[model samples]
Target: MIESILPSYVVSEDLFEDPPDTMLFPEEEKAVEVAVDKRRREFTTARLCARRAMARLGLPPVPVVPGPRGEPGWPSGIVGSMTHCTGYRAAVLGRSARVATIGIDAEPNEVLTQGVLEVISLPAERERLRELARRSEGVCWERLLFSAKESVYKAWFPLTGLWLDFEEADLSIGPDDGTFSARLLVPGPVVDGSEVTAFSGRWLVRDGLILTAIVLPAPATTAGSPPGASPGSELIGS
Candidate 1:
């Protein structure tokens, strides 16, 4: 059975338990493939875990179909996203009536190299990470930033149906009520003309696994839009 870790998020590790039998595909298989074994495995595992979690939530499982520009499309009535890395797999689900966007990500705690961090982080965000590192020694600030960026992508794409670059959104992380809170510095017409929104949320590490969830307010409704066409989108950035 799938397990619910938060009100709108759930997790499963079945993918880590049993890797997919890629050998089943013929050697001459012409399907597109990624050479990174670890990433392929993680993606496979994450999808399996998400399917099981959806079942536990009493929601019909939705096949994650990639839309134009690589965004995932969910079955009707639910807004959600998934992420998996190394040994972790997770999923987030939101009811259409309650939330317009939901994003979740899981990653292992490890030191991220300075070079890698620089590539993914904005200057202001790097400064905040420096402060956070000074206060909390050994925290994986770079990884968290990377994951948060990924989550933002997952959450944003479906709403705008547009691709966002890693530098488009800025993120800040700090201690809050015994957990970490992330605030997003998002700009442009995509955010409904708002310059920034505090996408507040929390994270926890349990048994060597780190899980984070961020829920944004449902976007304002338009005069003549489809029932599920809100301005908000959900994502997983790990």
Candidate 2:
């Protein structure tokens, strides 16, 4: 189901439930060793999803540990993200040569808790969400907005190594195209000699879940054979 929303170059794996055999490496287990049963289950299963994605990329299974900010630390030359919510867990990966960064998120298709939307959304974004709700029925636009911002932060952090607040990025959602655009309200990151002040991504709400993804591609014109090791030159399918 996750593959349906991503581009062809990305390798993705998702699971609706934790498998009985799910196991975590010693290093990976340390991150969740003290957590409750539910936290342990989700952390372990999400790594399982990530390793499966790694195998699909023709790479051997490796322990996926957390970085300083709790982001998954991918192997060298790999860019990826992991998300888990309720009954769903998913991971997506792409080669650094073809892709610069990747962000994917999943959330239950339910309206935001009262006052929660106001905390995560800008006034402009809230106004836009109201407009979107009028156009589309049966979809949780507020939750979708939160999910899109989560995805944007996932994609933003790895490149900038900095934090991005929900209020720092303004979003404009499309009611018809399953797409959204994010405009950075602060100084933007520069990739391959150009500043990226904006980003575009795709979203979907289906089967009681809301999924959002963002993939940025490496510069294709770099002098190196495969490509330069710099950040993305352009958004892929964004």
Candidate 3:
């Protein structure tokens, strides 16, 4: 899949593979968990791949943990997010100083459908997909839209410490300076100084996978001290 560097983040994808025995123990399993072993393996592989990507940029490996509502907990001084789907995995890492949050998503070409597309996309977005379909045969525009939406969610949640519905964000994708640029249209006070905050980044397709990367502006406060939080307020990792 695509492995490319953006201004502030690195985006890459890998074919899903089974994790080595060293990564898991037999005792920590159940029947359902065993049934989803392939997903577990892919997630493990994605984490390793993400670490390698960060190292390439001379950043220290940040430990990741599951925060409230299942968002990733990046180590102090860094922020990042990851996403994976069947047969593919992707990760994004960014320097905390430059970006407050970063997210990447990848999808296989076949998992998206027209019906599924209708549910997640707006009318204008659907029209754009139709246009892309008309101009380029066999490209999975729906899947790309879904992946872009997902990437936006991952990037937005952490900084705002709030959950947003998929409909809350609008996306525009186009060619920019030799790479695909994605623009985000976010609703509500989540974004700084406006109801809609826009972010732009690049994406590409490689090896039958669609890869996307986005960099989010950092919050003004530190991890435990989110903006607008009064003293002793509960900390939520959005």
Best by TM-score: 2
lDDT for model 1 comes to 0.56
Tens digits of per-residue lDDT for model 3, 16-69 = 654475242232232126546665666566666666667766766654545667
Relative to the unseen true structure, what is the C-alpha lDDT of residue 136 in candidate 3, on a scale of 0 to 100?
74
Which pairs clash in the backbone of model 3?
A: 100-218, 157-238
- Rank by lDDT, descending? 2, 3, 1
Once fitted onto the true fold, the runs of candidate 2 whose alpha carbons sit more than 4 angstroms away are: 221-238
Where is model 1 more than 4 Å wrong at Cα?
1-5, 8-16, 19-40, 176-196, 217-238
Tens-digit lDDT string for candidate 2 (1-238): 7777677778999999999888889998888889999888889888999999999999999999998999999999999999999999999999998777788899999988999999999998889888888887988999999999999999888889999999998988878877887888988877767777876678888889999988777666233422212234435311
What CA root-mean-square deviation does each model show from the true structure? 6.4, 3.9, 7.7
TM-score of each: 0.70, 0.93, 0.73
Q: Which residues of candidate 3, in runs, are more than 4 Å off?
A: 8-16, 19-35, 53-63, 175-196, 217-238
lDDT of 1 by residue, 62-110 (tens): 5665555654466787777776666666666656655556666777777
Worst 10 residues of 2 by lDDT: 221-230
Task: In angstroms, give how far residue 22 of model 2 lies from its true place.
Answer: 1.0
Candidate number with greatest lDDT: 2
- Candidate 3 is scored at a TM of 0.73
**How many residue pairs clash in each candidate at the backbone level?**
10, 0, 2
Q: Least accurate stretch of 10 residues (summed lDDT) in model 1? A: 23-32
Clashing pairs in 1: 150-236, 150-237, 151-235, 151-236, 151-237, 154-234, 154-235, 155-233, 155-234, 155-235
